[model samples]
Target: MNRLNLFAPDVRENPYPFYATLRRESPVCQVDPNGMWVVTRYDDIVAALKNTQVFSSAGLRVASEPPHLQRHNPLSDSLILADPPRHSQLRNLIGRAFTATTVASLETRMRSTAARLADEMLQRRVVDFVPDFAHRAQANALVQLLGLDPSLQPNFQRWTTDILSVAAISPDDERRMQDVRRSIDEMEQYMNDLLASRRRQPGDDLVSGLLRSRVNDCALTDEDLMGFLFLLFVAGLETAVTLMTHMALILARLPGWMDRLRKELDLIPHFIEEVLRFEPPVHATMRLTLADTELSGVRLPAHAVVALLVGSALRDEAKFQDPDLFEPARRAQASLAFGHGAHACIGAFLARAQARVVLEELLSRCRRVELRAERLDWNVSLNTRCPLALPIEVIPA
Candidate 1:
């Protein structure tokens, strides 16, 4: 597939068909512009994700770091790019703040925020789900969880957009690159200030918990803290935001399911899980070969870029029966939405909690959701899939 470019608009619009084709024709084939290998089969992707020794997470950093934006991208230094033993140390230290009880404790407050947002949206009757509900819900949840100033909530969307843009920049987009650089500086400074403030007078927040957390009797250095906070802000907010938006889209298109969910509230969790498996927020992830490795009998040279098509893997016919159908209660297998192994999202619990709360609130407030737009406008990105805007009319309960 020499002409294939995942970032191209056509492919990004609906990649599943392409993924299905690739999985059938060539499960491991090199794609265009950059001869990065794309692995589509479920077992192969799982094996590659688990075998981190051969497939390094540093590939994420490599993929994001273009020549002009090398040291400036905060994600380059974040935990997502690190491999063990450094990855282990960071995960062990930071994982303390995300315990089940702690994440659960934040739900009441999250639901409260969601309830307010839902009421406002339902009162409006017609509104864009992305900004009106999903983004706001996720932003407030992040603020509550991290004890960030509520005033700063407005900047979360911009920061997340600019920072993640680094991963999908076009060669000639100097203007976009400049924006990303500035956003990186601003976000890094904010994180540093927050870290210092937490150190002086700790609060009942994730930042303070991290300040107090220790690994092998050593406190996290300034760089580590800042990098982690950057990662946390983007991953924590974006993943859940996308998930909520996807749920809204589903509701808009599948109105009957909304009624089902409202009646069988218990099925909400299953619905979310199915969404994770079917319409995952992230479709793929990058990994670099640390040494020469072979995947599905295809030889890969050292330092080759590999895209683990987790979205495709989730729909692999081998792993999931009738993978194309959205089955909420089919007994889900392991999902790579938050990923697998050491590099799996540490904030997965918090993301899931926020989605559940927002979804439940929306269902309670609205009897049905109908899209105002004629078609979906997907956000342009390399790996993630979500609508840029979802204008919907909510019928109040």
Candidate 2:
């Protein structure tokens, strides 16, 4: 059996070359230590993602059951981890907040929020863009979306960070697992308080909307509400922050692209899509097989763990021309960055809207958001790899 360390720092930092080799030599290979299989080819991953019957989305809670700190335990309840009638029900119920009109309505507020953060970044001697700008913008957008106090942005950062840090760890690592549990407990408490207040005041926010919505005559129970909130808490802002950070790194390299963007504002959306292809925030997602199955001629056992390396697939030579190169104008089909099928990212448009607004601000205000390309820090985990700190200096345009 061939093996690869999905958690290795070097691999996490630059997994493209390794993924190319994996895709060519062994598209479906079993990895030791964790007894997991990896899917490196784009087509195989797409097939797996779309084939929810064979590749079940269950067992998301298994890893975080005991010694693990999980973002959402009993994950079966969450839409991301659910299937069939239940999944459709939840997605339809939550889909209202992200409708095109709703997001368009929020554009002004989102842009204003990004502009304020951009101004703050401009004032800094040397700003760590993650915490200083991208993280702040994401936190603000999420707070308003959920009707939470703006002062709790730091808390959101801590809770999401702690919860996400436990990915791919040994379930027996009790120490880290306990820490994750504590974070989840604290965040859940905060969520409970918010839910109560929303119940009383019934504001015009996502939580309140979910509280009022009933899909197929089904309403949100207390458990369902908490699970849904957990999904948004982790998924809502984290991807946007990472996407902005990745774009900053890219813009720093193509210092002249800012001027190009100014001349052709239309390229902004394409540029964001390319960034998602080249350096997506999420690298992999886990699925358990419902029955013994075959993927790309490789046999997989029933109840086995398989990791769909969509991040690697995004850079597959078979899928994209010059897969390793970052070109802003590349015309291509949608990448698996936002995932596919029933498990696809529901907040995709909302996140993209936030990223586009902030990104426009960046290109317009800064002569170039400068970063030391070679010194970038990345979060190395089983699921995603995101830039940790982009020490950027903004030269006002």
Give the candidate number with the greatest lDDT. 1
Clash count list over all predictions: 0, 0
**RMSD of candidates 1 onward, in order:** 1.7, 2.2
How would you encode candidate 2's per-residue C-alpha lDDT over 183-256 as one tens digit per residue? 78887888899999989999778888888887668778888788888877787778888788888888887788
Query: Candidate 1: misplaced stretches above 4 Å?
Result: 1-3, 170-172
Tell me the tens digit of each residue's lDDT in model 1 across 217-244: 9777777877788888998878888888
lDDT of 2 at 85: 66
The models' CA-based lDDT, in order, is: 0.83, 0.79
Error of 1 at 68 (Å): 1.3
What TM-score does prediction 2 earn? 0.94
